[model samples]
Target: MSTAEPQSAFKVKGQGTIYLVGLGHASTHWVHAMMIFLFPYIKQDFSLTYTEVGFLSMIMHISALACNVGSGPLVDMSGRRIIFLMLSLIGTGAALFLFGIAQSFLFICLLVSMVGAANNLWHAPGIAFLSETFPKNRGYVLAVHATGANLGDAASPFVAGFLLLILTWQETSMAMSIPVFVALSIITFSLLPREKNPHASSNSKGMNLRDYGSGLANILRTPAIRNLTLVIAVRGMAQVGVVLFVPLYLVDVMMFSPEGQGTTMMLMQVGGMVASMIAGTMSDRVGRRPVVFAGVTATTVVIVAITFISNDLLFIAGVSVLGFVLFAVRPVMQGWMMDLTPRELGGSATSVMFGVQALFGASVPILGGIVADTWGLIEVFYMLAAFMLIANVLMFTLRGEDAEARA
Candidate 1:
């Protein structure tokens, strides 16, 4: 009998592939956490209206959305993992450095947009890599990858919040650059192997650009994708509302100090981290539909509860539950999307899901701000709760066998 040689060190399988993807996703989580930490400082420094702040955030999300659409096919065709990874690191690091020194709102917005674009470059390729690497266990692997992001989200805010006490916002921004640079160095030197041309693979079925247009058209025509899109859109609106406004609510409505608000937010991240891991693992064993439906329903309940509570401890409890529900379903949803997509259109399908979510998230803060300005912050929470509940109903309608078969 002939013996085959062992695969290379970078040839990850099972848990290791999940870890690799998780590490890449951690960079995304850190950026999100850092942005939350900087929001208060930016608002104070720029003397900006809530609408203006929303617009700046919108620029970042919109830029990310655009990049995801543009980069999807290239990533699918090239299979240049190391190249995309290195570029993301460099671009994000440079943008962070520029952001630290930005003097005006426009400069800040521009830098943030660049950072968002960089992040977009990182995401699609990384996700596709994980999906392909662990085809049999896509949900489990993808969930673990997402868990890495939750870990970063859980930690970064606490670090950023603590740093803010000792440093200026610019210095805090500068500090955020170090991680991406380190991640890039690791990927360049050790973590990622040289990629084979995607066209060379036996699995390759070249995706024409025109096919992407058709794939999107097909996506729109499918009732499942359509409903899922609406569910995610509503969820995205609620997510933005909470992330952008929670601190403000803690400060103005609940009468908390900055430190207190930061601490509470940190707790939310902790809850989110735990929830992401648990939900991902559980969904692998139980099935995607149950996990997602339960999470969304729980999240809606938590959001509604928050509007009626004023005590700090109670509010933190609600936020913790909110965090759990908000993050727990993420992996299941992403897995569902992958399962729904044809193998040939993996990159394009994932990009469409992300694009829709980004567009929805981008619109929410502005709409929420308008509601807050016209009605009240409490009213914003009510709207967010309603959105979540509606999402829950939509998610419940998904066909389990259909989702599984597609995967």
Candidate 2:
């Protein structure tokens, strides 16, 4: 086995950069939360059928799916971290601004597609940066990064909801763009040092379809990577379904107002933030598999319990636990992917994982909507519980050989 050099210590400024990535993640969550807030306004304005709303979501997720693949190679080749970060934030902000002003469904679709594409640019590189910046403590650093995202998720709905109460949906969306714009400016001016692309030597000539295909094939053939992807896919499907419909469940089943729904969603984010931190640290010490298994199992249990809770307070408590279990495992999973792939293919591998998950998540919102329309929203929660249980079983099948090798 090759002996790897010891990684440098994490600097104060480096931690600042990770915080920036967290803020960026928060902005993405804000956008997502804002969308939920806008749904009613959008439906009222356009008289959108359920299918039309579903199609709009499909556009965003599909664009994210495509961009995830494209951005991987771009990040690998350039290693211009700040430039990519700035572009992503600016582009997403522009899309949101346009979305606020968009006059028609077609216009909104186009703008939202742009938002999706731009949002896709953030995760892989931001995460890759966190991984590279804190190589020695990748799991913990990534966990911190994910926690930042949870904070954003927690705040986004409340911000959007507050704006919705005072202003129109378009105005609320326009207001959401301000923080991202500020982030872009900060990134543009920040004096962060550029790090060498870990994968630079792997594809000096740049990535092509054949190269990507081969790399992807290599990833699939690797046992650990294969299992990791399966776990992500299954958990992703259930997570997306619940997240997309949970607001509706609160509104339709529990009879919460929009503001109340937003508050409930915020609670989920708070739970997630706490879980991400604790899980990330624990996984680094104890190993990724155990943390992941426990998290997923706990999540499944919470989802099933949510169906039985009739009191609003009990439901909120259950959902909060669900949030913690759902998000806590993300950083560990991401760290595991990095562990499996060589540095040279990190971006590609990350992209493949995210892209596939996004595609899977894309299907979920629409499917959950359909199920909610036919059965009850409670049925959707039960179905997710069933899926999470299956995912837990699959997770147990994962070998820790890759992680063990790292040790």
Candidate 3:
């Protein structure tokens, strides 16, 4: 709404809210990233095939997709962003704890489904909250939020891996779940006092179902939203695919020790942390498309280079570069989508964005599994590179950011 306004015109509000939300975001990601370390062990314990592992990933995405579709409206109408965030933290921790005690593959799948749904529930409220709090600095603020994720992602694998050295995979998962319950509890409960405390007030009280449908249709019809969603879906597919398989690749082909694997994963997140800050701030001033285009392009190149790399040190370095390029664009994509949609519909818009990502990304792991099964783990990186290239082409079909702002 204030696209033409000067950058200095609006002073940022909810400064504490931003950091608190960021901390909450970190805990959510830490819960998710810890699974990467667990996957190798899960695979070994179950004697699962690659396809089965991929199927587990698919379950996670599908569950997330289902939750994402509904969460937006719930957050928008209920005006209980912090409540949903707290619920998400609790659900993820419960799932992780129960996962450690899981006795059967079916039970594990069920727990994974719970994790997927609960993890995604955080995004609608989290993104909508920050976007509303700092509309002008959406890109920068969201990037700072993303930096929390980078820290969590960076820390979890190493922690999980280190724990794995002393404890069983089951024990590591159970142990890690405790902190999520503890640390995030303090942050979320502290916010309860300061939150708008809407107590389930409906923002769209007068809008009927038909009105909501029309609003959604209009939003979807925008070529920019559709194109960005598709590009993001592809990127999500690559990201989820890589996350699902990379640990297995490190374990199976590279023969990396648990600590070595953890450290490498940590490096990738460190690169991502740096990039999210720079790219997020840069996108705020320069517009979203340039930052997204450059990052996605570089990501494609880095992913391609990763496939050819066999040397341990070189491959680890390449992964860090991949993280810098690949992760930088995520918040930019969210900011760009926010710029295009109505502010009131921010929750629904975030759902649409993330839901589409989950829908398409749901297939990535299974597909990547087939590719890995047919060729090798290294070949999955090739698949990811191709997906990025397709996304880059999709980027060009989008209207320029200035046009998006005007819309």
Candidate 4:
């Protein structure tokens, strides 16, 4: 057997591979943000209520929930990390292209659901790939990959807004699909080599339902995994609450133009993009518990502030702070999970955590929509704050030692 280095250090080759994976990660959320920016246009065109608007994201989440659970193990089963990634990239383009042509509400929802599924399924394999590729730099490298999503998130609003000024929303959607085609071309022709999965437990032949169930059951049995999974579930509730309603508030209550809403989203995501990378590196040195606890605590405080503050500037500041803190928790948690799970089961492990997140993340928008329809949009922020506070309390359940464990 080969002598592998300690968990705290990385010995990765093909540095560009990390960047490429990061780019792949970025593409998922870039499409997501583009969809978000289209919300106003959709609402106006369809004469939709807040509930209907929330339903759009809700359907996507539902599809994502199912796919996230199965896709992780499938990636492990296939043993073709790069292949799954390419498919995800291609799916992104197809979804956007479909959206560009779709006329009815039903078809729009269907396309969104497809995009959501494709977007989410990437995380499991991508996380596993990076963990194997850069074992030593796990925190920073995962953060880089996650940072790509945030960059996509941050950039899309600005790009969409700029494009909206000149083109129809459908035209803009079609144009955005162009990047995926370009990215796919590069990935297809590029000399990116696929790394072997050293931790694959099943033989290369095939996996049965029993084997898949056993792997899943094994991951769910871990105390830390169960706890962290629940923590994210609660946090995701608050996150979806914020994301699903903020645009409505901007359009209906604040009377901000589409550009203003995009700018607000841009501020929050930009904060997240920069902070996530830094937080991941910091977690490697200080520990995941401190980073997550500190982040959730700050996020809770900011949510509370956003709840009360009505001024646009103050709210933007709050969004920026919330972005920085909330975004940091995701990658750090992934790194911690990687540290504890055996390499062979990393796929199932990541899936378990991500699937829990998707289950809750998908529901919140619809639930929050009901709240917005009943109480008002402002009330949703209060609920968002409450969920974040509860998540912070849940985070304390994570152990001191687990936080410091290296992969």
Clash totals in order: 0, 1, 0, 3
What lDDT score belongs to each candidate, Candidate 1 first? 0.72, 0.75, 0.84, 0.79
Ranking by lDDT: 3, 4, 2, 1
TM-score of each: 0.89, 0.90, 0.94, 0.92
Which one wins on lDDT? 3
Top candidate on TM-score is: 3
Residue by residue across 232-304, what tens digits does model 4's lDDT show? Answer: 7898888777766777787788887767888888888888888888888887777678888888888888877
TM value for model 1? 0.89
lDDT measured at residue 66 in model 1 versus the true structure, 0 to 100 = 90
Residue pairs in candidate 2 whose N, alpha carbon or C atoms collide under 3 angstroms: 199-344
Candidate 3 lDDT, tens digit per residue, 99-163? 78888999989988998999899999888877866777888788988988898899999888788
RMSD of each: 4.7, 3.2, 2.5, 3.0
Error of 4 at 44 (Å): 1.3
Candidate that beats the other on lDDT, 1 or 4, i.e. the better one = 4
Per-residue accuracy of model 1 over 1-407 as CA lDDT, tens digit each: 11223232234354554575577678766776677667766887887766676777788789988988877777666544556767877887788767688888778888879877887777667666666655546666777777777776667776776777888878887898788778777766654553543323213445566865786678668777767767877787788788888877776678765567767777887787778777766765566778888888888888888788877798888888788889888877877776676655666666777777888788877877788778888898898888898897777667655544434
Comparing 2 and 4 by TM-score, which wins? 4
